[model samples]
Target chain A: MSHIRIDNLTKVYMGRRSRPRNIHDPEEHFGDNILVLNDITLGFEEGEMVCILGPSGCGKSTLLRIIAGFEPPTNGTVRVGGQVVSAPSDQSIFVFQQGGLFPWMTVYENVGLGLRHIRDAATKHERIQEYVEMVELEAFEDYYPHQLSGGMQRRVELARALAVNPDLLIMDEPFSGLDFLTHMKMREEVVNMHEFLRKTTLVVTHDIDDALIMGDRIVVLSGRPSAVKLMHALNFPRPRDFEKNPGLSRLRSEIFLMLGVPYAV
Target chain B: MKQHNDGEPTMKDNPEQAPDSGNRSLRLGLLSLLVIILLWEVLARGTGWSVHIFPDPLTVVFSFVELLRDGTLLRHTVASLFRVTAGFYLAVCLGVPIGIVLGRSVNARSLFNPIIQFLRPISPLAWIPLAMLWFGIGDPPAIFLIFLASFFPMVVSTTIAVQNINPTYFQVAANFRFSYQETLTRLILPAIIPDVVTALRMTVTIAWLVVVAAEMIAVQSGLGYLILDARNALRMDYVMNGMIVIGVIGLLLDNIMKRLGDVESSKWGIQAR
Candidate 1:
């Protein structure tokens, strides 16, 4: 049974000054709409981890937004758990490219934000502590977002998202600029957290290794006006260590060729 | 420029956080005060100026002691404190919400900015004659002037704070299904505190300054009245004492505000702002 379904989704962006916003400005009415995503129909089952792999300017993030209910597609409908998603809901959480941690809140407060709705302070506190410790930020619970390293801030974001106990976690390049070591550590953390929670997760990333490390299934997307070009299931085992895996490079090249980029390394 | 901060690790060697910085500042301030008094004493003695005109530091000290003994200083201080407190509190109550509302709507801000700009520059003192006619002489007119002084900055800073908020915050808030009340009290208020508290110090200073001017004209029985009455009687030392009291009180109030802001900011980690 599909938990999320997108049927023939299409997004067209109006260029700046290219078109009038309303019919009142008839003289300024221009008809130049740039197509970003075309016929993007995809679905995933319960507890499945899916990664959408695409290059820059390919609108993968836009597609994630459409699923997160932050954006509306010009065509096609999206359903989450048999219900159409027209607006953002507590059932789905989106982690932005930026960590988006509230600067004025301590790590504990940031993580505990949504848990207040749980209606029991003791239970909420326990859940917050659980998620914060899961991300290895137990020591910095009282510290604010600015006091932590960039990676730690991202963990706070992750912790906050998880605290809500959402059914769907939509990530858009959540680890864009971290050093490789932190990236690997965080990826492992995400994998472990997913295993622990078994939430349906969808991550959109341009980094090929990001897709390979945590994704159960990878959906490749082409450039602008992008549609799914390929979908591959890894034959490798769970939590495979890509640093030592010999089979990873061949898959990387395959994706590169599909993306029309010259293979490097 | 915005010094009312969480007092973070700006000084690398002192990783002990707030206690060290606050102590050092207090020590430095006391030393500077002693040095200034010594300079005044020497200059008054060296110049051989008249006691009535250039009353020495000792005279000011003696006059302050005398006022303290008679209990007039307490009465005047309480009167002034009451006016400024009522006025500033009212301003905060009125200004912050209005600013947040205007901040949410850009069209509203643009529409109102010209009116705000026009009214902002008109000195609160300029309203005294009108305030006197409306509220009459005593605490009301002085409080009104102080209110005018503090309200504008609070509104302006809060508006800017709301206007400049990152859009991601709202998206996250939406994701969590927060109520309007939750978004304001938890997210919006905390987000604006750093900016709002910085302006808080400025508004307090302006309020204190206007209270003196308003008291000198529109009201009676305050430090301002003390200064004016002493001058009329040619009691130069008493006038000097009143000036000293105003300066010291202003410094004390400002320190109290900065300390309050620092304490609140530290809870949320000040450096991030």
Candidate 2:
């Protein structure tokens, strides 16, 4: 069943209006503005991992922000589970491109931060430990964000989002900053976590291989003032091994071609 | 992880292996002080300079002992310390919230910015006459001057720190469904803690300066009053003693502030040198 619905959303930013220095000679004013997002509409099913692939300035992040309710659309509406999203909701959590772990907090503290206000302390502690262990950060739980390496901090952020138990997880190029081996490992771990939790996720990225490996369905967006270009459903089974699967490479090539980029191999 | 010794081993050396080196740095520091004292003694006895003009360091030390014995120094030090503490606490209580509000809301900034800017450059010492007229000759006027000195810098620095916080942190807080107050208390305050600590250290120093100046004019009992009294009586030794006491107390307070800043900054993952 579709869990999220985006209906004819539009955003326009009005520039500051200039005034005449001479008050006696006033001229009639016309509205001058920049159109950032044209009308866009899409939907996503529950428990589905959807990748939004687009170019840098394609308004992909803005669209994700609108759905996450960080910013309101100039027109139209975004609904999650039949409720209109006017502001950020606990049901839809956003994972930023940079792991926004609080520098003052240790790995354990950062993961536990959102759950700290819960009246049940024992449950909160257990949940924090479970998520920390799940992310393989048990050894580094006491270390502050700066003390840990970049990849470890990212894992902490992921653990934090997962611990909240949101209905939909929104990721904006979460693994893009990691080194090659770490990136591959992160992809595998994220997929593993998704399968275990069975939570709906929407991922936005520019990497075709990343989309193929992690996405259950891929939505391609065109250039500036982005609109959906194509949607491809993956027929692969759960816990698919990308290294051993030859079909995954073919899908990567198809996505690259669709994005007007030549496939390297 | 490996410890390397490039020079003479000192008190910082590993005590298990180097028992003799453990006290070496302490001994050196003591020896340096003795050398300075001996040089001063030689200059006092040997030079043709007037003994009254630049009294022997021993004379100054003796005057310090005499003031302590008479209990006057203690009373003055306590008075100065009290005024500074009261003023600094007041600044912290009022300045931080105003700063946070201005930093968070554009409307608050627009409303408060002009008034703050107008008052910022007015010297705290210049307020002494007005403070005297309003508060009368006591600790109140002195404290008011100190508060004026410390408040502006603290608020301004805090506002800058809050304004510069990464927006991503706020977004994360909102995604967690945090209320406005929770966001400010949990994320915003913690994020700017290091900067706030720095501002505090700076405020304390400014408060000290202002309090001393205020006490010189508006109050009858303080380190500043002691200096003025000594100058009026033409007892240069007491004046020198008061100045030395002020310098030492200022150093001690600054060190305390430094240690507090280090402790708080380290908690926020900032490495203090």
Candidate 3:
């Protein structure tokens, strides 16, 4: 069994009010089911990093949210470490695209939030310190989220997720709106942290550069009513320069082909 | 000019700006007060107004000095402030937690919204006769009437604030598996503090306003009583003095609340500093 298994997962959001119940079979709506995910099955091996790539509004985030236990699948099962997932647990944490950080909390407080639940006070301070330094926010431990720049806030989110030290880390477009310089720097830090820690990770992003830079394996998802359109194992080494490499260029084109948009560069 | 393009201004970049603005504001306020006083003095003389009807600024000033000398002004002011404080504090204690429930729970909102709407429009002064009958001419009735005046707005503002908080914070709290207490202390409460403080400022003013009216009916030691008593004695100067004192104290109270908001860390965070 894979470390994480999403088996025949299908999600149908009730877009509008349903008709009166007694008139027809309830399953009739299944045909018109605004299917966001369609019987998709995927797996992530332990100690591996996978990036689910697709165009915007392609249900990639919905899939990630489902796997993170934030949403329920209409007809499927998600198994993490051979346990059927029910509710969001401390085993995994989702880092939102917009950095869903607590604005009121100082850096130390936000990073140490997860530890407050488990009541392991002895190592809580030390682990929070370690994660804070890992994300290079040592001097900002007392600052609120609003005081930090966008990039700095996102780093705090990363440190917060890492401080929990979960078996799985899921991120949704973690670098979407960042400037070019900050984007480059953040991607490097993310990959560095992943390499050093080697936790099972899944990232969902539309940006091909982010997928290429951090993904050990990339899964391409199609447009609305999405399914796994393509999956490719990337055998690239650490610090892989996709900007200068022909193989990475070819791989980027492949993703574009899967997304049905032509690769320009 | 150089810092405009960067969009982030530090104290080092704008060394003397804050104090300069504060200084200008103080100068402007003092100038406005002087202009108003001069206008009042001139208008009374120019109109040949009776001193009984419109006490000139000099007469009002003399009345103020007499009140101070007799300790009546201090005692009345303290009594008014105490009533406002008691009522405002009681309103806060009763309103905030209930507001949270009403904001977060549909059932609680359904239960309370109609009752609040009904009680809200009835003026605190309308309760004056009933208050006088029930509490029998003491500080308690005035305080109760002030609390009634303060309660509705505090509840409404706090409920709106809590409801306006982004759903994302709750999701973050859930993501960490936070306990109910943790969610309240760490997430919900902090997010609503700015709104609660703003509500407090509004309610304190309401409480202050109502205490004057309440004191006029049921109490005998506050500025409101002083106004009523002076009017009966036909001491227009003393009545004018009481009005002036109330206005000045209200302004001072507003500034204190403004300072409370200005110095808050949560307030800074809400502005996305």
Tens digit per residue, CA lDDT, model 1, B170-272: 8888888889999998788888887787778888999999888888887679988888888898989988887778888899889888876787563466644
lDDT of each: 0.85, 0.84, 0.85
lDDT tens digits by residue: candidate 3, A152-222 = 99999999998888989998888889999998899888888889999999999888878987999899987
State the lDDT of candidate 2 residue by residue for A196-249, as single tens digits.
Answer: 898999999988778887888989987756667888888787666666787876
lDDT of 1 by residue, A237-256 (tens): 87576566778767877887
- Model 2 bad stretches (over 4 Å): A17-32, A237-251, A263-265, B1-7, B11-47, B264-266, B269-273
lDDT of 1 at B168: 91
Share of native interface contacts recovered by each model: 0.85, 0.82, 0.62
lDDT for model 3, please.
Answer: 0.85
| Model 1 clashes, total count | 0
lDDT by residue for model 3 (B1-273), tens: 543433343334445677655655675678799999999989999999899898899988888999999999999999999998898889889999889889999999999899999999999999888888888878989988998998889889889998998987787788899889888887888888878878888878888888888878888899999999999998999998888889888888888888788765657455534
Off by over 4 Å in 3: A19-33, A117-122, A243-247, B1-17, B268-273
Candidate 2's displacement at residue A240, Å, is 5.5
Against the correct fold, how does model 2 do in TM-score? 0.89
DockQ of each: 0.57, 0.63, 0.50
lDDT of 1: 0.85
